[model samples]
Target: MKRPIRVLVAKVGLDGHDRGAKVIATSLRDAGMEVIYTGLRQTPEMVVNTALQEDVDAIGISILSGAHMTVFPKVMELMKQKELTDVLVTGGGIIPEADIKKLQEIGVGELFPPGTAMKDIVSYIEEWVAENRNF
Candidate 1:
């Protein structure tokens, strides 16, 4: 049988707040997905490296430091460098809609903003992984 879907939920940069990340991790776990949460103050490289090490199907970054532009692009670049093409690079926080569009254009997956439903996040990850990851 195939192993459970694995997701890496992370808090990047100086975002000391992590309640959302923890909640998502727990919810994903409860939803039957294996979740690895890289706690607060993570760099893009660190987050990507941990995702690689864990062999996760998806990477969920929780950033609220107004660094979405820098964080998402840097992580995307590193993911490409590591050839983690199949891994979903997604995130959520206080990001503007225009910025979300830009990030999506550059290959970042669906980004959730504050107040997005947990069920939506879970379904999005599950659908993306089922279609993309070779699990």
Candidate 2:
């Protein structure tokens, strides 16, 4: 049997609010994907390293501290350095639409804003993994 998709959900930087991260983690787990949730106050390097060690198929970052600009790019850079290019780096929070576009331009995947449906998030990750990850 093929292994289930593995995802690492993280909260980078000083974002103390982790309710959303926890929700995403649980939802993903319920969707049959394995989720590794790194609790609050993580750095970009730490997130990437954990993703590597866990061999996750994606990294879902939950940021509400207005650090999307710095956090996403730093994670992307670290992923590049670690040759984790196949991993999807998607997330959600209070990010502006323009910033989302910019982050997408920089190779970050879809950035869902607050109130995005859980099914949508689940479907996106499922489709992304189906297309990108070689099982």
lDDT of 2 by residue, 1-135 (tens): 889999999999988999999999999999999999999999999999999999999999999999999999999999999899999999999999999999999999999888889999999999999999998
Residue-level lDDT of model 1, residues 33-123, one tens digit each, is: 9999888898999998999899999999998889999999999999999998999989899999999999999999999988999999999
TM-score of 2: 0.99
| RMSD of each predicted structure | 0.7, 0.5
The whole-model lDDT of each prediction reads: 0.92, 0.96
Clashing pairs in 1: none
Highest lDDT: give the candidate number: 2
Clashing pairs in 2: none
The 10 consecutive residues of candidate 2 with the worst lDDT sum are 108-117
The residue-level lDDT of candidate 2 at 76 comes to 97
